[model samples]
Target: MPPTVGERAPDFESLLCTGETFRSTRLDEALDGGCVLVFSAFSFSAIAENWWKRYERAGWADFDVPVLGVTRDGPYAQNAFLRYLESPFRLFSDVDGRVGEAYDLLVEREGMANTTTSWRAVFVLDADRTVTYAWVADDWISPVPREEVEEAVAQL
Candidate 1:
């Protein structure tokens, strides 16, 4: 099950495009004075990146907190995806979905052959690493309502 609203978040370490390492344990260190939004992708969904860019341009990055883009792909693939979408947020590789699994956000095929794609999900975490908001998109084309995230962060 996912962490409850007031529960401590699970910590995870993953590689990022910045050549730096990250994990939920370091969330507070990264956000110190700001909030964070973890955007998880199903695969190569550029739409998600587009939505985040809107927030980035709207001054979300000005908060100085890290907005992490998490995926199951490695840093090499993530680099390509970010470059193609002109994404500003750093991408973190979940590789085998351990992080997703810990958060109860892992979505894998039941009987399909060798499928590894994860379901699209988003989680907003405060500097304390507690999950403040969560959403799972129903489809690849579904957009993450900007105000929903903004309003969540505004609360922090």
Candidate 2:
């Protein structure tokens, strides 16, 4: 199961894509005022593209807290995805799915044998890395509860 509200988020280190370059990042070190972590199966897919576009339209970039995306794609693909979206935030490359496993978001893809990916989910973390809000999609394509997430971050 995924972390719930008030639970401490699992700390993780992964390759971070800054749209222009790649670097190592740890969850604990990235915390500031707080942050939003978005998990998806992969980058460059139709569903993933649309999901990020929705976030962009929702003004997620202007939130008081930083918003970061995590996916199993490598840094190269992540960089291209960020550039494609013209995103203001960075993305973590969970290439080995270790971060996904740590967060309990790893799952085998339906109808695809031997393939695994992170489920679509959103988490709002406070400065201390405690989960203030958490949402995991029941299915692959469900949209994130943006208003609820925004409220959670605002309260933090």
- Give the per-residue Cα lDDT of candidate 1 at 126: 76
Q: Pick the candidate with the highest TM-score.
A: 2
Steric overlap count per candidate: 0, 0
Q: All models: lDDT?
A: 0.64, 0.91
**Per-residue CA lDDT of candidate 1, range 1-156, in tens?**
666566667766666664343333444444554455464654365665566666678776665456776677777777776676566677767788877777776665556567554556666777668777776766655767667777777777
Report the lDDT tens digits of candidate 2 across residue range 94-130: 9999999999999999888988998899999999889
Worst 10 residues of 1 by lDDT: 18-27
Model 2 C-alpha lDDT versus the unseen true structure:
0.91
Residue 12, model 2: lDDT of 92
Off by over 4 Å in 2: none
For model 2, what is the error of residue 110's alpha carbon versus the real structure, in angstroms, after optimal superposition?
Answer: 1.9
lDDT of 1 at 105: 69
**TM-scores, all models, native as reference:** 0.75, 0.97
Q: Alpha carbon lDDT of residue 57, candidate 2?
A: 89
